[model samples]
Target: MEQHYQLLRKHIEEICVLTDEEWDVVAQRFTYKSLKKHQFLIQKDQLVPCEYWIIKGLTKAYAIDSNGKEHILQFAMEQYWTSDFNAFQNKVPATIIIDCIEDSEFFCLKWEDREYLCHEIPKLNHFFRIKSHYGYIALQQRILSLLTETAEERYNNLIKKMPKLIQRVPKKLLAAYLGVTRETLSRF
Candidate 1:
């Protein structure tokens, strides 16, 4: 899992100036795994045990609608973290599914380990608080976009944010994420 440590170190370094010692502490908590395409990282209605940091390939967090449609909430690429924080926090069953879109490698950390970080290194608390704040803001922005933006607008935004995913994610999945039909997405 040295690769996982390196990836985490890079992310921590970007977020805050992490000393080698601090990085070591973070590194010790990571567990690495390889996932096949279409396999789940976190399945719907299951308890979230860990949060993952993507080291390779792609993954997405989504929810199934009442009509059995999958609505993508977020996508993670290399260096990104994916998890259902609500379930992780409350020890409740997850309402979302986190699935790999490709053969993926990830560094995972359990909830208890994160709590230890806060207790062991106070600076990490600041770092995590900021991370959580951004998560909240991003979620809010997504909700607003779903309410205000047209399907084409959402699709265009997705391309701007993750241009590669247009070719990587299945077209039907992409369309559902953007609240468009597959034919409409194809036309665009």
Candidate 2:
């Protein structure tokens, strides 16, 4: 539990330093959770009560279309955050589902607690703002890639940017993420 908190501190410190007092305040607001492989973290049409910071293992955020095809949106691992951002922010039902790819542990922060922490600590607010900016930029880049790049190009770019992801995520999930069939992905 202490180690998980330390990991959270390190993740935040990458953006901005936190004083001990502030850290204590920030730490207490989070609750620990663990889930086994294949467990649902956020199910579609359900409420998203908190955003989770991964302490260990991997998870995938995806949506199932009316035809029952899974569309992978994101893969989150240790030190990464995962949530149904649209629902979490709007206080509505989730449009996507998040599930554990492996047994996972996380520190969960409810929306109200997050808001309180941001208001109480200016540096924490700055850290979150920077993190959100990066997330937005990444999302934009992903959209542009899907719109303009071929599957092969996207695969090459993903390998170049996040080789570890290729190694960690299953090929089928990678295929879905790249908007390609498994057979097509196999050719790359």
Clashing pairs in 2: none
Model 1 spans > 4 angstroms off: none
Candidate 1 residue lDDT tens string, 29-117: 77888999999899878999888888899998988889987788987888777899899889999998998899999888899998998
Q: lDDT (0-100) at residue 47 of candidate 1?
A: 94
* Model 2 whole-model lDDT (C-alpha atoms): 0.92
Those runs of model 2 whose alpha carbons end farther than 4 Å from true positions after fitting are none
Q: How many collisions per candidate?
A: 0, 0
Angstrom error of the Cα, residue 124, model 1: value is 1.0
What root-mean-square deviation over C-alphas does model 2 reach? 0.9
Judged by lDDT against the true structure, how good is candidate 1? 0.85
For residues 3-75, could you state the per-residue lDDT of candidate 2 as single tens digits? Answer: 7799899999999898899899999999999999999999989999999999999999999999999988888
User: Highest TM-score, which number?
Assistant: 2
